[model samples]
Target: MSTTALPDIRAARDERVVGALALALAASLVVQNAAVAWAAAPSYAAPMTEVLAFHAEHRGAVAIAVGLEALNLPLLLGFLAGLRGLVEQRGGAGAVWSRLALAAGAVLSAAFGLYAVLWIGTVLVADGLTGPTPLLELVWQLHAAAFAFVLSALGTTLVAAALTTHAGRLTAPWQRWLGLVGGGLMLAAGAASLPIADGSSLLFVGMPGYAAWLVWLLATGVRLVRRAA
Candidate 1:
C-alpha cells in the first residue's frame, strides 16, 4: 500500500514556531533601537560639524548599529508576513487595510534600508569627506526625508492592521487602542519630518513615535505567544 503524502513541510502550522519568530522580531527591534542609542546620534541642535566629528570618532559603533538595523529588516518582514496572513483570514472591509498594511510595511522597510546605507556611507567617509560637503548634507537631509515619508506609510500600515485585527479579536482592547495611538504618532512624526529634515525640534516627535512602535511590537509579540500557548 502506498503511504499518504506527508503534509507539506513548509505549510505546516506550528504555533510555537510562529510565536517565537514574532517574539524574535520584537527583540530584534529592541536591539536596533538600542544600537541607535548606543551610537548617541546627534540631534538637530548639534552643529553639523559636531555631528560629523561624533560619527568619525564612533565609526566602529555606527557600523555595528547599521549591521543591527540590517538584521531588523528581515525580522520585521517575517513578522509582517505572519500578521498579514492572520488578518487576511478575516475577510471584510477591514481586510482591505491588511493588504495596504502589507504594502506599506515593504515600503517602510526599504526606506529604512536607504537611511542605513546613507548613514553608513556618511560615517565611513567621515575622515576623507571634508567640511560642509553639500553632497553629504544633501544625502543626510534626504535620508531624514525618506524616513518621514516611510514613517507615514508605516503609520498607515499599523493603523490599518490594528483595525483589521481587532475586528477579528486578534488583539486585546488596550493593545488595539495603543496601536492606534502609536500609528497616529508615527503619522504625525512623519509629517513633522517631511518639512523639518534639518534635524530641528519638530523631529523630536519621531522619538515618541519610535517608542510607541517598540511598545506595540513587544505587546503584539507577547500576545501572540500567549495565544499560541
Candidate 2:
C-alpha cells in the first residue's frame, strides 16, 4: 500500500472499532434491562415490608442486575470516548456538542455506579434483617433517586451526541429529531426526581425516551459499520 493510503486505512479501522464499541454498549444495556425485568423488583411506592421481602427473597436476581449495571458503566465510557473521537476527526462543526456528550456520559456512568452500589447495599442489608428497617428503606429510596439522575445525565448525553453527529453530517435528520424529543422527555422526568423517588407517576415519562436512545445507538452503530465496510 502507498504511504499516502495509510490514513484512509487507519480511519476505516477506527470506524470499525468505534462501531463495535457502540454495539457492545447497546447490548450491555439490553442485557441489564432484561436482568432487572427478570428480578421484578418492587416499585419505589411499594410497602416497606414488600420491598424488604422482595430484596431478601430475590437477592440473587437483583445481584445479577447490579452486576450487569456495573459492567455497563465502562462500556458507556468507552462508547462515549470513541464517538467523540469520530466527531472530532470528521472536523466540521459540533465540537462543543461532542465535548458536552463526553461530560454528560461521564456523569451518567458515575450515576450508574452509585445506583449499582446502592442496590447491592440494599440486598445485603435486607438479607440480614428479619423485617423492614428505616435504613434499608432509605437506601432503596436513594437508589431510586440515583436512577432518576442517571436518566437526566443520559438525556443530556443523547442530545449532545445526536447534535454532534448531525452537525457533522454523520446521522440523518430523523435520528436528530428522535434524540431531541426523547431527550426532552427524559429531562422532564429527571427534573421531577424528588417526586419520582417518592413514587410519583412522572417516572414513566422517561421510559419511551430510554427506548428511543437504545434505538438510536443500534441505528448509529449499524450505519458506522456499513460505512466502514
Candidate 3:
C-alpha cells in the first residue's frame, strides 16, 4: 500500500465520521416510519392522525417516504467511493470485484434516486386527484427498483468482505449474518405487500421492514469502521 493510502483507509475507519453517517441514516429511517404512520393512521383519529390522513389521501404524502429513501443514495455513493479507494490502494486481485461492487452500488443508488424524483414529481402533479392509487401506476417498475437496491447492497457487502485484507478486516460473521437476515426480512416485507389490497395494510409491513434494514445497515457500517480503526 502506498504511504498516502494509509490515511484513506484510516479515514474510512474514522469513528466520528462513521457515527455521524449512522445518525444520518437513522434519521432517514425515521422519515420512512413517519411515512408509514402517515399512511396507516385512521382518517377519524386525533388532530395529528387526521392531518396525516389528509396527506395520505394525496399523492404528495406518499412522496415523503420516497424522499427519505432517496437521501440514502448520495451517502451510499460516497461510502462506495471510500471503499473503492481502499480497494485500489490494497492492489489485490479482488480489486476488480470491488470495483464491480462499487458500480452496483452506484446503480442501486441511482435507481432509487430516480424513483424518488420521478414519483415525487408525479405526486406533485396529481396532488388533489381522487383517482386510483398512483402507486399502482408504476408498481412493477418501482418494485423492481427496490429489489435491485436490496440485492445490490448485499452484493456490495459480499465483495467488500472478499476484498478486505487481514489488516483491513472490519466485519465478523455475526455482522454478515445479520445483514443477510436483514436483507431477507426486507424481501419478505416487499412480498407481503403484494397481496394486501389496502394501502394501509401494505404500509404496515413494507415501511417498518425498510426502516429496519436501514437501521441495520447504519449500525453495521459503524461497527465495521470502528473495528478497522
Candidate 4:
C-alpha cells in the first residue's frame, strides 16, 4: 500500500471508532434512563417519609440504575474525546468548541458520579432505617443539587459539541439547531438549581431538552458511521 493510503485507512478507522463511541454512549444513556424509570424514583419534592420508603423498597432497582450510570460516565467521556479528535482531524477549525465540549463533558461526568454516589448512599441509609432521618434527607437533597449541576454541564457539552461538529461539517444544520434548543433549555433549568433542589417543578423544562440531546447524539452517530462506510 502507498504511504498516502495509510492516512486514509487511519481516518476511516477513527470515524468508525468515534461513531461507535457515540452510539454506545447514546445506548448507555437510554439504558440508564430506562432503569431509573423502572425504579420509579421519587422526585426531590416528595415527602421525606415517602422518599425513604421508596428507597428502602426499591434498593435493588436503584442500585441497578446507579450501576448503569457508572457505566455511562466513561462512555460519555470517551465519546467526547473521540468527538474532539474528529473535529481536530477535520482541519481543526472548531478546536475551541471541541475543547470546550471535552471540558464540559468531564465536569458533567464528575457531577453525575457525585449524584450517583449520593443517591446510593441515601438508599443504603434508608434501607437500614425504619424512618427517614435528617441526614438521609440532606444527602438526597445534595444528590438533587448535583444533578442540577450535571444538567448545566450537559448543556455546555451539547452546545459546544454541536457547534464543533457543525463547524467541521460533520452534522446537519437541523442537528445543530436541536442541540442549541435543547442546551438552552437545560441551561435555563440549571440556572435555577437552588429552586430545583428545593423541589421546584421548573426542572421539567430540562427533561425535553435532554431528550433532544439524546436524539441528536443518535442521529450524529448514524451519520458518521454511514459516511465512513
Which structure among the candidates has the greatest TM-score? 4
Task: Please tell me which model should have the higher lDDT, number 1 or number 4.
Answer: 4
Q: Local distance difference test, per candidate?
A: 0.70, 0.85, 0.52, 0.88
What lDDT is obtained when candidate 4 is compared to the true structure?
Answer: 0.88
| Candidates arranged by TM-score, highest first | 4, 2, 1, 3
Worst lDDT 10-window in candidate 1 = 2-11
Q: Which stretches of candidate 2 lie over 4 Å from their true place?
A: none
Stretches of candidate 1 exceeding 4 Å from the true structure: 1-15, 88-94
Instruction: Please count the clashing residue pairs in each candidate, in the order shown.
Output: 0, 0, 0, 0
Model 3, TM vs. native: 0.58
**Which segments of model 3 are wrong by more than 4 Å?**
1-19, 41-63, 88-97, 133-167, 184-212, 224-229
Q: Judge candidate 1 against the unseen true structure and give its global Cα lDDT, from 0 to 1.
A: 0.70
Candidate ranking (lDDT, best to worst): 4, 2, 1, 3
Kindly list the per-residue Cα lDDT of model 3 for residues 1-229, writing each as its tens digit. Answer: 8998987667555534544555576677677767757666332112333433344475455666776786777666666565555555455545665576577666667656655665555445445545535453344234434443454454444344334422244444454455445545444544543333222243333334454456555665667556556
Question: In candidate 2, what are the lDDT values of residues 1-229, reduced to their tens digit?
Answer: 8998987787777788877877888998888788767878788888889899898788878877878777777777887788778776777488889899999999998888888899888888888788888899899889889889988999999999899888877678899999898898899899998988888788899999999899998888888788889
Pairs with steric clashes in candidate 3: none
Error of 1 at 192 (Å): 2.9
Query: What's every prediction's RMSD, in angstroms?
Result: 3.8, 1.3, 6.5, 1.1
lDDT of 4 by residue, 10-86 (tens): 77788888888889889988887887788788898999988988888888888788888878888888888988888
TM-score of each: 0.85, 0.95, 0.58, 0.96
- Residue 165, candidate 3: Cα error in Å is 9.2
